[model samples]
Target: MTEEKIEQGTCLRCGRVATLHRGLCIDCFRKSSEIFTIPDYIDLTVCRSCGAQLKGKHWEYGGELKDIIEDEIHSSLQELSGVEVSLEDIEMRRGGEGLYHVEVRAVALFPGGGVIPTRKALTVRVKSSLCPRCSRIHGSYYEAIIQVRGSGKDLLRQEEAVDRVLERVDQIARGDPMTFVTKLVKVRGGWDIYVGRNQSARRIAQEMHRLYGGDYKVSSKLVSRREGRELKRFTYLVRLPPWRRGDYLLKDGTPHRIEGFQGRRVKLKNIETRREESVEISSVETLAHYPSKEVEMEATVLYTSEREIVIMDPVSFAEVNIKKPPGWKRRESVKVVRVDGGIYLL
Candidate 1:
């Protein structure tokens, strides 16, 4: 009889006829080998201002610290860089200042149909860094200063105009969170606003000029010299006209009502002659300012006709007859302004 040779290799676990790998059969090795790799420690950064977590180079808005810590622990674990990790349970608690300890229980599922239960204890380090917007605001930094003033404008009107301009500026700032204003100062004849970004200041100046019909001029002053170059700070001057629409001004003893601003010129209508003219605002002197409410008085209608409306001044009871403007309703009570030697119905 021929001598028989027996296969010698046996599985490490069951002693079966199987190829051995690292002293284990293929099946046993797949079941026993460690296929998961995770770090004992993880590190992440949080924004000091907005509670945003830094993921790579981007900011992730995380609502709470515990949620961020949990997410960090889950994302840091990997199953041999290819296996899928299914989390079973996670427990995290604060260890100390900016330190969190996490205990995780998960299952590693292999592509080759193997599953392993895993338990890991990880420590996370939380570092605080200012977010982009908060960093810009930390130093009270500004890129532009807008000086609002007029040559002969009324103080009250200029002040009110600044209020309107600030409202629009606030709207822009809300749209772009990076744009901000550091200070809004009440200056003579107008307001001076310090803005945080050049684009914000430019936007404000442009919108002011477009809506209110003004002009803006820009200038820069050398703030610092560095490395053979000068660092200059920008200033924007928004020049509003001296008069606004519906304002009454006395020019050369004549009452002229402001129509509106036309570029660098002011449009006005003579209250007495009923003639309209546009002129450089500086040529006229404002001997008197007539604000509508301050100048208006309650006048009772004494008589009404198609061509004329007669009114009795409540203060002096003087019967006054005036030609009515078109579309006058001839109400029993009317708003009228009397100054110097003239009376006009509003």
Candidate 2:
């Protein structure tokens, strides 16, 4: 008589051929029998069709599993912060037997505040499934958020902040169960400078430098100017050294009292009196020699028709206007001195 071979059956869960059991396979057995441990307050439900597991009481089929996972994450966030997360409307797709694809929307709330003034949103597409026996598995294809908070006053700032937050989220999600991850695909808007004046700018720059050291850049620029015909107004640019910190005060919502000067005027003082010299000088020839009561002054900066900057003293101002200095024509660099009210030769 010929020896008979045993027929093998396959597991419905993993599709691996069964070794010892019949009907339902061992892999399927473990998956079906395994219990999912959830937190005490987390609400969970089960699929009625094949006794498969489901989460939340409102579970429905045909919806993407990724959407379900995102809902779970949002629920967890709500539990942590005690705030409800609003989800934006989006389309979801499902693939394979247990796989799903979806775009999810959610906002993060700050402590003691109703959501942030700007709405922050995250979009995620993930693939996940639950076996007929209730085994759960998930994989993310792409995930990101479109907005995040920052200290800048423009769209780029918000985008940068969102990138930073999502990167941190990714790290947490990969390491801890309490954390979740998402990708940022869009940012809503930009940041506004909280401090607007020169003093405020200095303070802000100083503080940032003190905290972050040489790792950051803090500077300010003039956005607009209103000049009268008699008083020619010019915009000033102040650049703080890297790693300095100070506050920039605001005036009527605009930055003022900033360091540095603009235009062709020298700031002078009476050496003996230690007081500011008035701009109404009687005559140019009266300023012939360095007075014993000389007050230090910075060089006046003049702009050429071509917008080139030239630095000279009040005495040489007329000469420079009439005839450009021989060496000055070939000079392309500005010499900055370190003295108080110092000179800058351009």
Per-model TM-score versus the true fold = 0.62, 0.20
- lDDT of candidate 1 vs native? 0.73
lDDT of each residue in 72-96, candidate 1, tens digit only: 6666665554357888877888889
The CA lDDT at 22 in model 2 is 29
Question: Looking at candidate 2, what is the lDDT of residue 225?
Answer: 54
Residues 20-105, candidate 2: write the lDDT tens digits.
Answer: 13233444543453211212222334353323334433334344434455455455443222233455543445445443334444
Q: Model 2 segments beyond 4 Å from truth?
A: 1-147, 150-152, 182-346
What number of clashing residue pairs does each candidate have, in the order they appear? Answer: 1, 35
